[model samples]
Target: MLASRFGAAAVAIMCAASAPAFADDTLKKLGQFQSTGAPGEIPQVEQGGKKAENLRAIAPKIKVPDGFKVELYAIVPDARHMAVGTNVGVVFVGTRKTKAWAVTDRDGDDVADEVKEFAPSIKKSNPNGMCFTPDGFLYMAEHNRVLLFPAAEFFYESPDVAVEVIAEQLIPKAEESFNHGARACVVGPDDKLYIPLGQPFNVPPKDKLPLYDEQGMSGIIRMDRDGKNREVFALGVRNSVGLAFNPKNGELWFTDNQVDGMGDDIPPGELNRATKAGQNFGFPWYGGGMVRTKEYQGEQPPADAVKPEIEFAAHAADLGMRFYTGEQFPEKYRGGIFVAEHGSWNRKKPVGARIMFVTLKADGSADKAEVFADGWLDDKTGRYLGRPVDVAVALDGSLLVSDDLSGAIWRISYKD
Candidate 1:
């Protein structure tokens, strides 16, 4: 049939092109899809019931400022990052697993009415980071590839939809790792896709620096929306799961998870700022906040390595961050920042499992970092009730936070 549709020569050429893709499981899985679905074919995610009630039960435990309130928004399994669509009021969530979900509120209520797997026809890998462009294109950043779904909000109901491959094989197969596999992507002011390619090691050897730098693996790279003309935007990053662009000045600010194992309270996490291209944020050399790593202690870092705007507590595991551009909150929250501290993993005493609110000065400089919401971590027993992953502003000016532990999304809004 293919030969009849595209001539004998064209079919031969296409077969040769696709022959290599079958060799890799990652790309092979992506090819398993259907243009349509059978009876009861599409997978559906239950929206409410016990799982949601449990999340609501934990809501009162979540403490917020006096004027603010927290409530259950949706029950999404393994929800990691969220992207709100333009005009449709649908929120697309990505997970570290294979599923990405589309959360909807059909009755104009604050709570979600439906939660379903998005584009279930196509298989996926770790689609953890995602963001939407203003023009209705949803970009999903997998561990090693990026996929573009146009009109995602409107076409989410169908299992089959148009999907475009923005980039294939972001890194070599040999370089892929389960550690630090979460990649963050955002559309910059210049309409370029800025994505961070994390290093696979806690502290890599010195000999690998040049190769990693050339591959843009240990840095943030920006490419044209069509995945052309890619260049490294920043270097020396350890692993940054969060990326946000300040609206006022168009500068990029990100949260970097510093090197671990130094001690519980030694190297600190960082929230960095980037104003231009080719800038380096100290990594391997300085694990976090000027503390040199043992691996590269004998070596010197770049003299122009940029320091962080705010240094968070060690092992806080700061992940996704976003600028507060909504108006439903108090005036103080306007033009501010909201970052999710995923909490400490190996720390003797757990430090964070909360949402941090950062204030900006009149000149758009970050001034302070304070906990806007907490109670996710039990101080006495060191138990985690929930771990917040990412934060996004809803269309109604509220904040939607994704929690992988609870497999749910929570909404924070101001009532007073």
Candidate 2:
């Protein structure tokens, strides 16, 4: 059933990506499919009923810092990553699954009223990470390809929106893994799309490193907005789910999920800063933060495996993050960062179903990191009420947190 729905785009992607001639033929067919979709016709998600109430009930348990509070914004199932629209403040959410959603508050009330699938006719596979360019083009980085939607916000009301396949075959078919395959992308200050491709295995063999590196399967790769001139931007990443360019200095910052099975506490997760392209963050050799992986213990890591800006608790599963450019919050948070820790799944004692506030110094280095909101995990029973996957800042200065575990988008705002 799943394949029946998303099969066309996926099939086109695989075929078109094999060669340029085939690409033109298959992708054109897909675009023809795109333009024929019914206008002003959108399939909607069931917004009201028990699910929304249950999600709202969990909001009271969400403990925020003083002067801030969180409320249920919208019910967005499998919300993994988010990008606010360039013109109308619509929030486009991507998922690890085939579906992506467009959420709108519609009234500037800080609560989304409509939640609907984006490009419902496209049927792309795992259109997971989404980023909007300054000029209004939206990039959706899928498992094996990257797509561009021009005027995504304006055209989103219709299924017949103009679309382009920016890049093809992000990873070879044999090398792609369902694990760690949710890609995260962003339009950098340089007008390029930076996409992080996670290595599939817990720890890959040494012999495969060169192939992975050549394809940027274990690192971040960037290309021109139109998907031209592609090149690897950084390397040695295990699985980076979050990518943000600091508005202060245009440096890229991302959160990396450390390797698992190294015990719950041995390999810490990372929050890295890429001041320049081609930097490496240790992965197979060092699971995270210098804790070498047993798979490559005897081998030498890259000579310049740059250290992360901040090392998070082991197995915290840090995911989406964004710099705080909103004035709704106090001065301390205005120029800082907010990150969503999806929390650890297999830790002996669970930790990190929370949002973190990291204050940065004048030089763009992190000065401190602390929990800004939590209580998603029941301390008494270890049950998770919600697991946050991404953080997005709104036009009104509110913070939107996407929770796949709870199937909701939460709005966090501050009042003096």
- Give the clashing pairs for model 2: none
lDDT of 1 by residue, 37-143 (tens): 42335577787678877889999999999988999999999989899996678999999999999999999889998898987766789999889875666899999
* Model 2 lDDT on a 0 to 1 scale: 0.84
Pairs that collide in candidate 1 are none
Residue 207, model 1, lDDT:
87
> Under the 3 Å rule for N, CA and C atoms, how many clashes does model 2 have?
0
User: Against the hidden reference, what TM-scores do the models get?
Assistant: 0.91, 0.91
lDDT, candidate 2, 205-265, per-residue tens: 8788889999897899998776778899999888999989999899999999988988978
How does each model score on lDDT? Answer: 0.85, 0.84
For model 1, what is the alpha-carbon lDDT of residue 25? 26
